[model samples]
Target: MSDRKSNDEAESLLAGLMRFTGQVAGGTLEIARHTATMTAMFGEGWVRQMLLHSMEPERLEAMADAGHFLRDARETAGLSLKELADSLGLSDKSVLEEVERGDKIMPLELVLRSASLLARHDPVPFLIKFLRTYNPQLEQVLEQWGVMALPRQYERERRFVNLYRQHDALRGLSDDEHDRFIQYIDGAAQLVLDVMQKEKAANSPPTRVPKRPSPARKRTPRKRS
Candidate 1:
């Protein structure tokens, strides 16, 4: 290989290494912290990113989904990144630079606030971008670590699968027991769907309640000294 080609490859590899380490150091913020409480289900990983980062994945995928989202917000309000950044006391150029180089990482609350101020929408979508930036293995490993995610959950899942199979054991259940069995299965399914749907909706659009103005209060005239 030519020396120049070798140098270029080395540079790319180093950039990737730096980015990866940057991500790992940032992993607590990206994956472990954000994904707490519930582990992913679909065989999932930020569904949209999972596709592109998935390989042959997507420059075609959800990239436009969010940019378009942010763009509309920009146009609708006739605000430029600079204008919004100035409003927030930030350097207009830095904001654009981050967007162009795609290095924008901010806390969730700040992202939302910035999005609202800039786009008239929440900035939470940056979350998908964050998750997409991470390696999902970190989340799985962290979850499998420590007391909070004790193997007990996996064990319980295994046991539940076992019980569910036993619950289905008949050549077919007798009619009376069959109805109860169906109810059990149906109820279990509904419970799972309910949990998943709640989760999906939760992850979708954030529900923002604009701060309400405090109620009016009557003021008494000044008392004489």
Candidate 2:
């Protein structure tokens, strides 16, 4: 009876030890899995932040007051407040005054119209100054994209005059011929512009992130005879 009791006690102890070991192993595995999951999530977030930072345009910490620029442009154009208001089709100078004082937020359409009017007075200088004041990043991006070199007012006028002269000269040609000629000219111009843009982009600095390498697989040991 004593031997049986000792044997029973030993068996119970062994079973408890086994259960405790199993629980420890399972808990360790769960903790390891949780750690790995957390690490992966952290890595993903870090990568996303880096990507966004790299891709986002450089922005001003504080934007210039739109009204200030409008007021300056108006003054530079040598227009009186009343005249500016009248040109904009306002009944009175109250809106202009508010804008000039930076007390009221101007609408995008009004801002654009103001810029256009200023551009008529001084195209290149006004555009450069205005864009730099409002959004320097846009100016930089446009320059990088190779679209900043727009035709001047005189150049556009000359182009239209030349087009008219050419049309008159080609009046003797058939209508179909004239249409084909115009299409060819347009296609050729577009092709040239496309090529120039492609070259510009190619020359620009690359902004892509390097890819991460995959983990190597563990090799299984060969069975020995």
Candidate 3:
């Protein structure tokens, strides 16, 4: 009778263990299924945000002064202080300097000139940001274009490509002319790539030196029979 009672207790314990194992397995499967479903519903960026939500959020820089923005835009377009001043038809650099130093607000004509000169450098967004403070309607226009979320560099590149395609010179070109145009475009692309590579190399973090592997022991070759 005692032997039978021991066997019964062992069986009951084994059954409970099996049930607990099943519950754990089921829960793991359910979690995996839910994760897959979520991945399908939302993109990887959404999933990444969820995983990183507990970390410190990114801090956005305060909007730059309008004058500073213009200066930077001019520099990005490879224009010097004097060149920009001359382009604006100023006799001396004092006005440009004063505007850049935030000592004076830019006049409408100067602002328009700056925009035209900096067109290839994506000056619109910065201009919009600066103008919106005084003109509320600009905010609505920016919202319509979804420019707030788009990156400035990407927008600039997109605009450049679009303008290149729509240029009057590109329209109605013969095959030979088209080929020459493509070659010119290729040269321009190379120049842009070189500049970008130089900038990236300058700004990139220094690479860590890799550990040297241990030298292998010299082995004598065996003669084949």
Candidate 4:
């Protein structure tokens, strides 16, 4: 009788675990579909936010100076507090004022939108500075990844890859699952970088090649002769 009861309990637990795993798999698939449907810029922005959200809660909370970073980015973008608030669709500018003063955590959605809007000002660098300030663990990981020697252009991609690895580890993905998802993330990051490069090139002013001084009028020597 005891053996039968033990077997029944073990089977029930195993079934519950299977159900939970199925739910997680289904949810992941749905999220992947939705994210894949987003335009490149928006998709990359979403991925960046996902990385930000993966930070340890305690570290995130201690990020009191995040407001200062936001304020600096806003100033660099040449936006007034009210202007930024309006752009972010916030009805009250004072809320943003509070955020700028380091009194509040920036909402996740706001972080995503703000990062996109502040692209010209290099929001990724701002985020990296924030990480360096508040999260030593992430800095150590970045150091391990040889972040310093890499050119500035690839910083966003490297940071995203690192964060995606952290996200996978947190999710307890199997080795095979991690390998597959990481490849996808790498492709997405490359796509984003390509788009950004193209856009930058398109918006750049045409290079004006200096006209050679028409061989300085060879006839002048003939006239002297």
Best by the TM-score measure:
4
Query: Over the stretch 1-225, how does candidate 2's per-residue lDDT look in tens digits?
Result: 999999998997678657645654564354446546755778745643443343323322212344555665676467999998888887999877865664433443565577677656445544443343333354554565455666334446644655656545676878998899889979998999999999999999999899999999999999999
In model 2, residue pairs whose N, Cα or C atoms come closer than 3 Å (at least 3 residues apart or on different chains), thus clashing, are: none
Ranking by TM-score: 4, 3, 2, 1
* Candidate 1 structure lDDT: 0.52
> TM-score per candidate, in order?
0.28, 0.30, 0.35, 0.36
**Candidate 1: stretches off by over 4 Å:** 1-68, 100-109, 119-225
CA-lDDT, candidates in order:
0.52, 0.59, 0.63, 0.62
Q: List model 3 lDDT by residue over 4-73, tens digit each.
A: 9999989976786576456545643554565568678897557535633422221101112566766766
Which candidate, 2 or 4, would have the higher lDDT against the true structure? Answer: 4
Residue pairs clashing, model 1: 52-57, 52-58
Candidate 1 displacement at residue 181 in angstroms: 57
Compared to the true structure, candidate 3 yields what TM-score?
A: 0.35
| Top candidate when judged by lDDT against the true structure | 3
Worst 10 residues of 2 by lDDT: 55-64
**How do the residues 173-202 of candidate 4 rate in per-residue lDDT, one tens digit apiece?**
778987888799789979999999999999
